[model samples]
Target chain A: MLVYIYDGSFPGLLTAIYESYYRREKPEEILAQDQWQHTLFAQEVVIKTDEKKADKVYQAIKDKISGFAARNAYCVFLAEVPGAEMLIYNYLSRGWKLGAKLDFHLADEAVLQVHTVAKKVRQEAHRMLGLVRFRLLKHELYYAQIEPDHNILQMISPHFARRMADQNWIIHDVKRGLAAVYNQVEWVLTPLERPKTISLDETGLFYESLWQKYFSSIAIKSRKNLRLQRSFLPKRYWKHLVEMDESRSRFAESSVLSPQSPVKTYK
Target chain B: MELLEKLEILANAAKYDVSCSSSGSTRKNKAGGLGNSYASGICHSWSEDGRCISLLKILLTNYCIYNCAYCVNRSSNDIPRAYFTPDEVAKLTVNFYRRNYIEGLFLSSAVITSPNHTMELLTETVRKLRNIHNFNGYIHLKAIPGADLELIKEAGSLVDRMSVNIELPSASGLKLLAPQKKQDLIIRPMDYIKLQIYEHKEERKISRKVSHFVPAGQTTQLIVGATPDTDLNILQLSEKIYKNYELKRVYYSAYVPVSEHPKLPQISQPPLLREHRLYQADWLLRFYGFRAEELLNESQPNFDLELDPKTNWALRNLHLFPVEINRADYETLLRVPGIGVKSAQRIIRARQVRAVTFDNLKKFGVVMKRAQFFITCRGKYGGQISLENKLLRQYLIAKPKPIQHSSPYEQLSLFNESVPSIPSEVMLSNLTGEL
Candidate 1:
């Protein structure tokens, strides 16, 4: 069994893929070196991150599968799953070999699993579209931050930049310390400093108040269901939700004052 | 008032309209437009009801001259109302779009001043978004009932989709709930939009170069449980809209009991599960080749609440099942309980190569537990011993008790403990390899 290791970056992963195909090694035999713990009897090779090697792999993937599939494969790799390295390598090798006919065969567990992961990532990307709330900062750059479950900041940036082609806005993936900034006409990705807690501006808070008031006013009093609302946009996300403070506060106040049932209220 | 305040007020007011989805359309960026419409589905935010928040689901103004009892923004309601200038709305849309907050704008209103006045403001906003702003993203404008025909046609040219809410199904209900709104006013414009879409289609077929109009098509929403209308009436209305108007969708919003109006039903909560069931039924009618007459007739008004519409229909007609998987036609396969459109397609496609067995069906991601009873594998039966196994049917639908094997819960706990060592995005992305 040949075990392959890389620097645990996207380019590094691509390079490893290049090597696996180059050496004609089965993907199952390949193991990420960081994950490899001295397998008693296997040939191991460390794949250096090379742009040329990555490009070669990318070209090969595009040639075999659609560019869409290749990009999806890269996105799957970005997920950073434990067995993802081997799984993707296997999926690519097998998928390419099978050709376009591979889509007809969802029978393969590896193909099905990878497809499911891709779908989940896509679903999260879509959900973030609705859940993401922006805060206007002091710089006039409409700023917002998100701690997404997936690396979706890049996936979501182009849509915003094209639609908002006259204003500057920055969407910082605070958890990843990566940001996508659009300056009216174009957008680019940038890395932020060791991310600390960002202070909410007064206008941000004011918007929060207004938004909260708006949300409360629209919610049907007779149909208010906190449990269900919390299920989708979990309470943990409420702190960032502009319209959520008053509801949570109201709940707290009611619990303190009346305790049981607490009398559900909405405007 | 400043533009921001107006935006907040109007956007907030407009939030109640439910058809803001950016899905079901495939408009790409044209010569001058900014963003493109995604056919694969976009703008997937959900309200508290877990409904999709696709477009900027907001109104131009909550201030109204009409007093619809079901609507919170009715003019008579002593609520803090606001209105947005055409520029303010355009700016908010640009900002929201720039931030990736909304697909475009879902600009609805409460008949501010009059229908014509509200319609004029809306048409102006959409025109600016399309021509002045050169924004081509998806714009779903609410066509105000009783608005001028010329204004409606002009607005339709600038937007991707348009809707005129049939808040109530019948004329009597409309009169009872919303005294100001007339059936003719809403239906007439819908008739006009339908004719326009038809004419546009015919023109495209011949000319092949005329710019597409209402590319996303038209859709309407019916506030269910608000009036004493049954599922049959609602489905019938939806069917008519789909057939006559060529509407893209008929959204059924389970009426949230908000106000204590004399004409309204004194219910505690909206029939959410029922609304969900309607969506399922609607999907079946649209995609699965099922008809309204087949699912619900004059006798059976409401859908079965316990079992889903498909499952209920399948149960009521059981002799149709146990059809041969490899040989049964697409329609026959679709009729089988627990078999969806995707699953049926999978069966058809996979069976072309080899005869699909029980094992093969499972491999194709079929829910075998539910399907096991209804299918025979290569003339072999593994279903209930007796054809009339009522207890078995109950068991099939019964909830399963907790049983831990590989223990995904434990795995998740371990994952949570280790997450602090690495970034959550990378960690989640790596696990599923999705992002």
Candidate 2:
């Protein structure tokens, strides 16, 4: 059995694919260098990332198979799940023969595997569009910390750049030690260390408290279903959300103080 | 009053309005604007009651003049009343939006002095947010029923969506519970907004420079289990509204008894399962190409408690069952018990390349448990039982066990409660009878 290994990068993966075709031999397994496990009987091949060769393979996939298949390959790489590299290699090998009709062959195991992994990555990126809560630090820099289940920092940053175009912000992924930093013009993804503590500005605390007040007051008392609530916003995401934390809400203390009158005029 | 206190009272008052969607708009941000609208809306959070918190749903004020029996903020209730200035509302929306805490603002209000006056307050707040704050987020404004047409038109041009709630299902029910509201008054603003949206779309076809007028279109809400209306009445009304006005959604809210009156039912719990059934039937009308009259009739006016609407319909019309999976078109496939829009489309796409087998159906996202009784693969039936309606129903009926609370101590505390817990079998029959 033959095994192929490359550095864990998108270009490196594409280069490995390029080698499997031109070398005229199909490897039994394709893995990233970090994920390689030693086996006694397998022949090992190491492949380096060549930019020109990776670009040729990328252009060939887009021109021969379809642009949609090219996007699916990129999303699967970002997913970084175990055995994803092998799935993409098999998908492209079959896609080269079927051309643009590759995705329509959903009954095939290779095509279905690529489509399913890409969908999971896209869904997590969409969820982070709403779950990232930003806090205002000193000097007016907006900072948000997220611990997404997948590597979605690059996937969701373009949305924030388009929506919050005039503000400087940073979305830090604490689990992966990565961040997407934006400077009101463009954004770049870089490695970032998680901070031990974070301090909010004066007005930040005020707005957070106000948001907590709105969150608690809007729930109907008669329809209290914690099971349903956990289904939508799962318990794993509660640590970062401001409204879900019990210690920060102060809801019980505030509701105890009764108002003076039911009718009051305001200017 | 502090702004925090006002927000508490007004937000609590507005919690009963359950139109929480912020979708169907693709409004782009200006060069230096603060935000933009998403095409498919993002739900920022879920409340404790399991509802999606997509927008900052609040009221500008809770002061009212009309006394509706079912409303918590009726004039005779003497609840805590507070108002926010237009500037205050604009500031709150911008701050909350900056923190990524909400998609936008869902500003509604009680009829303070008159419909026109109340509408002016709501419109002015949206205008301030757009012009002064340079905010381009999704905004859904409520159109006051008896307000002038000009006010409704102006509000429509500034917001992403507009709604005018038809609180009761029927005209007579509206009269019995809310004497001050008329059906004609509620529908006038809806009709006017529909015309304006049509005109805006036509103008945009001529030139791309025309601005949007309610790009997300209109939606409305109706209270369930409050009047003597059946599920048939609610579904037919929704069908008429969707056909005539081209509404994006019609939210059905189970009546959470805020104040008791002689006209309202004395039930302790809301009819949530009935509301869920109505939503299911509504989806069949909108997406599955099923008509209202086809799903329910005078003989059987409500959905079965153990089965969803689609399964019930399939069970009644057993002649249509055993549809050949390879030969059935998209519409026929949609009528099957467990086949949905996504799976039906997947089957169509997958069949173009290869013949789909029964084993391959599950990979395309088809739920074979309910579908096995209704579909065939290459002229061979996959169901385990004989094709009889009664036996098929017995096999298909979802037997959801009564939810067991974790602790026996909690069940013991319920012994002193006024309402006795009914057995699951009796409760199921009772729910079907009541609906």
Question: Against the hidden reference, what TM-scores do the models get?
Answer: 0.80, 0.91
- lDDT digits (tens) for residues A94-209 of candidate 1: 77787755555666666767777777777767667666666665556566667777788877777666544555677777677777766665676777532333433455455545
Per-prediction DockQ: 0.17, 0.64
lDDT of 1 at A208: 48
Model 2, CA-based lDDT: 0.89
- Tens digits of per-residue lDDT for model 2 on A1-267? 999998988889899999999998999888888889888998999999999999999999999999999999999988989888899999999999999999999999999999999999999889889999988776677788898887888889888998888888889888987878877887877777776555557787888889999999999999999999999888888887988774353212111111122121211
Task: Give the candidate number with the greatest TM-score.
Answer: 2
Write model 2 residue lDDT over B1-435, tens digit each, in one string. 999999999999999999998899999999989999999999999999999999999998889998899999999996899999999999999998988999999999999889999999999999999999999999999999999999898889999999999999999999999999999999999999999999999999999888889999999999998998989899999999999999999999999988889888998988899999999999999999999988999999877777899998887888888898888999999999889999999999998888889888998889888998899988889987857845777788756578878744443454585445668778888989953
Candidate 2 segments exceeding 4 Å error: A37-39, A246-267, B400-435
lDDT of 2 at B96: 88
lDDT of 2 at B9: 96
Interface CA RMSD, all predictions: 4.2, 0.9
Question: In model 2, how large is the Cα lDDT of residue A76?
Answer: 91
